[model samples]
Target: MSLIEARQADPKRLIAGATGEWEIIIGMEVHAQISSRSKLFSGAATDFGAEPNDNVSLIDAAMPGMLPAINAECVRQAVRTGLGLRAKINLTSVFDRKNYFYPDLPQGYQISQFRQPVVGEGKILVSVGPDNKGRFEEVEIGIERLHLEQDAGKSLHDQHPTMSFVDLNRAGVALMEIVSRPDLRSSEEAKAYLTKLRMIVRYLGTCDGNMDEGSMRADVNVSVRRVGEPFGTRCEIKNVNSIRFVGQAIDYEARRHIAILEDGGTIAQETRLFDAAKGETRSMRSKEEAHDYRYFPDPDLLPLKFDQEFVDKLAADLPELPDEKKKRFIEALGLSAYDASILVSEKAVADYFEALVAAQPDVEKDGKAAANWVINDLLGALNRSALPIEKSPIKPEQLSEIIRLIKTGVISGKIAKDVFEIIWQEGGDPQKIVAQRGLEQVTDNAAIEKAVENIMRANPDKVEQAKTKPGLAGWFVGQVMKATGDKVNPQTVNIVIKQKLNLED
Candidate 1:
């Protein structure tokens, strides 16, 4: 089901107020910085952190007679991203000068796309539900267009009390402005859409999708209207950096609009800023119409045109995206949908999981035992240490060895965790650690029976209770495992304890 359908299925999704039920319409204009070594029109370095204005070139500074040159790599990345989104690619697209004056933009006019964009219509599928974690329902959001544009420089306001500092390092950097249709109905859907978008761009290597680093950001257009009424005028919320902030901003803005209309006040179409500290949006300026920018084709650059073969080659070389990988994990590997989704959320995690499984050829027959370990133990360890999967101390081969030990019954699951920690902290082979520590599971029937008998004799009262309540058999099993120092296989301990207690089915 699409997000709209899912929301319609849930009656509680409708917004309620004194006036009536209202529906929120949301659209997004996401700016993703192209991952290239140099600026779009100049050879200036595109490194994230540099001395202020150190990476600027003549073209970036808008020097006299300086002309803009197209970055072929940026164009290619944009086309790849468009294809990944399943969007239309306009082989021929023109660049126009967006007339806007700001201190950060040394060039009086920002060169952007107006009438023609490199990539045309596209759609992205987002998963939506409560907390975005229930049954996965696909929501197809329409992409209006994806256009290539230059980002303006930063104006550092805190540097000086009297004057602001202009940093041209980011000026003329290539950005893909991906505009979406107003199909979102709630804050959860908007968050899910942004998350899916970020995952796709990261998987494609088009953009880092690092909102904290300003590599990607969103301009949210939000408005509210009565159910079955015409769309209301939207107010643009500019430059929300984080996904959490996006959801918070939408909630606050929708409520603000609803309150205005309920109070007999008209909603103003204007630009707003989300103040993360205050958790609300404040008016920046009136929203501008297309004519306000006075957009026209730039005389310096010509229209971009490419052949079908070029696009075909790009499509051929595209990496397997998240959705495809998730599907394969579910079907071929027999993984649960929740587990597959978690593994494929990040490329690094997915690659690590694939490598781990590849190292253990019997992973498929084990019903994804390796996946459970990676998700529960390895990821838990990494998260506790505040480290990324890339920096994991345990390698895939090492993890595979650990799984092999468990599958072969060389060590119990409880003992394997100790081995994992020893290998993670002390850095030794898992098998060697198990051997050196004598952590092998005790499978001897005689030894296990002796342990179970000892436990029953010591806990006569508990044994009597076990006779009455058969579920208390687990308590006797735990005592056996503890007596054996957790080195015995839990299954063997359970069988022996059940037989000794005469509780065997």
Candidate 2:
């Protein structure tokens, strides 16, 4: 179902806000590391998991005479991401110094975008649903700006007993800081926004979208006010890595703000830290403004501009996005909205599904049935094994064959499950495996009649019970299948059992 159908089904329940008379306003500032070979302004390697300081360059460490130079690939990637988000790309933008103090920040200032960003005035659409049945509500989240920035070094505190260490491996790395307008109204919306952002960046290939490795992070801005009232004082929750934690931080911070206001206390404007263990936000520092950063144009680097032709070419090469693919799946492939939604949720899964569908046979094939098997049986097994679709031992063609076998009644459901297990582990032609193992269902009338006769002779009392109580016929069918090792097709067993017992259809 679409979000519209869901809302119409239960308008009051799903739309109800926990704040009662208050509205929870949320915006997120996401910092995604640019996927490139080198840092923004330095020649340092942008590889992760390297030795301390191995990826650092003289410019990254603020050497006296080192000069900054832009990475063209990083710039192109940032622009690509902006275009993917439907943001307007600025023809020109400047780099500024964000002055700050930290042990790992040897430069004492960070190169960042201020006043003018590379992208502006865009929107992202977010939705949520079950495997496929979940409804997608189109929440138009406004993008304020997307700027290019350089990340600071990492301070490692757990390395030694007393002295801490700094890892400059990540220092000077390129980052795209995408800021959003305060349009979200609840924790669910916050989650939806983050998820959609992750998908977009992943699709754009601007970032790897690996939250666990800190390739992406979000600074959640949350505030609460009485319904229809002007926005309240917002607090910034910094560096929330996971989508689930982002939603939790928003919920916790909004409630904290509301409690403070209800108790006649003013909500403080500050930066806070989310403790995943406590599930709450705690004060970090007073929120800094642009003046605190001492904003000024960088003397080492000049203003950046792009060739219009190059950008147009890049846009032309853009791949199919999640929304577009979902729509086409429904319209062209005749897939249900829910099914399409599931296939498009992740790029790899969608690719896998499409590859199988592309090779689908025209004769005696059920496209929707094939989709159901892929979605439920195949995906369920993959999840249970803690593997991705790419890692599944069962190839698309193999799974497609299994679906065909079940459709042709060449095997019973129980027998098909066994065949799937074999294919999942042994990795062979599914039909050959079924043949070698004698796994095909015995659907012939004579075979089923023999099994039914043997079952009735052994259970004469149960046969009498089934004749009197029609529902008890199913019990006789189960006995016959058990006696025949379940190779007998279940439907055929049911037919022969009913015939033998003189039970009406």
Candidate 3:
């Protein structure tokens, strides 16, 4: 077997079917639009939301006299993305004509790369499972190749009853098709792999990786077989817009295959479209073999050639990617693997965490506290508010201020959360809020002692029970804090409550 097909599926990831257990094998071809102002072979505007055909140039329209001139920025971006994938960069690669008929394709054939792509094999290490407990099962997904190509326009079939309208705003727009080896087995693995791949492209700044914008999408190839058997016939699910939908399509298709096999039915190799509303895959057409396209080298464009320095410069400018940053967070800052993974999942989230740590110097030693607040509190609040991290009401400085107060015993954790809600709703300096509102924890020994003594006096019956059943001291502690408006640190209240009740720690 080739290196890409060498591995066996994890027994745990096998799907439990009607009659027996089956294994699923998945491969993905992710088409990511190159982040550029112009199209790949023409100076046509690549802007979205423009009037139909307004962004297209004479070349994009394939006019008789027009010649193809590649945008250098698109090529540079493709190369930079290849380097970011940790894939080998080919010094030379050729563009070929993919012959096909489509309503939206202005050119009779799509100018694309084949045989020798710009990028070679690469691997992305994805961690699956709960993504917590500082625990994960790492799976290495192989990237077969990344080829540069042009995107077709959108066909607006709903605009007319029988006639169709073509919007060439996206025509000739640059794209990088990153194909993965058949290394994924389960829907969860496919989801994680897609997420990590998107994360990489986003980190590289080559593609925005926005599926909703039609800037990025995936074609999933799914096949199923019994354990210890060869690969079975695969069906391709086309243009799954969302990562969630990708998983849904795979789950539905794999089960369909398993059920068909169990019932003694043969599988057909076909291209299918995922009906997300119905949660199933429907046949689109017969799956095309490579020879069906009749691929031939494009006569208009020359081969893409770049030197080592070109690739070297782009690699040198790359920012710390997710894996490296995650490693640093775990080793240098002492963050748990799960926490580190979460913090570095997005570049903005990682930036927020680093800034928070920079703001609170004490958290540098142990970023678990900062990670918890970011992942649990700030992220949770952002998600609830339907806001992105960039639109956060609580800045890094503002949150670090709250952390400072809690660490310094200026406010109890409970009071801090109250302050957090107040700050979350309306902006304010956390320290100033605590000072102005007298919200600081009542850490005074005399104050706690007085509250404890009063609770003992009022509940004389419970005070006796406290001495015998020492757990009743907890009841006294709560009542003392309640009597004092819950402004005191529970830890200090517990200590003094124990002293008043004469109970051991």
Highest lDDT: which candidate?
1
Ranking by lDDT: 1, 3, 2
Off by over 4 Å in 1: 1-12, 129-133, 363-367
For model 3, the run of ten residues with the poorest summed lDDT: 1-10
lDDT, candidate 3, 81-168, per-residue tens: 8888889899899999999989888788899998988898888899897644546889888888999999988899899999989988
Give the per-residue lDDT digits (tens) of candidate 2, residues 379-482.
99989999989998988888788877887888877777888898888889989998998888887788789878988898889988887899998888788777
lDDT pick, better of 1 and 2: 1
Clashing pairs in 2: 129-134, 130-134
Q: In candidate 2, which residue ranges exceed 4 Å CA deviation?
A: 1-20, 130-134, 456-477, 496-505
- Candidates ranked, most accurate by TM-score first: 1, 3, 2
Report the number of clashing residue pairs per model: 0, 2, 0
Q: lDDT tens digits, residues 448-479, model 1?
A: 88888888889999989988898998888888
Q: Which RMSD does model 3 reach against the true structure?
A: 1.8
Model 2's alpha-carbon lDDT is 0.83
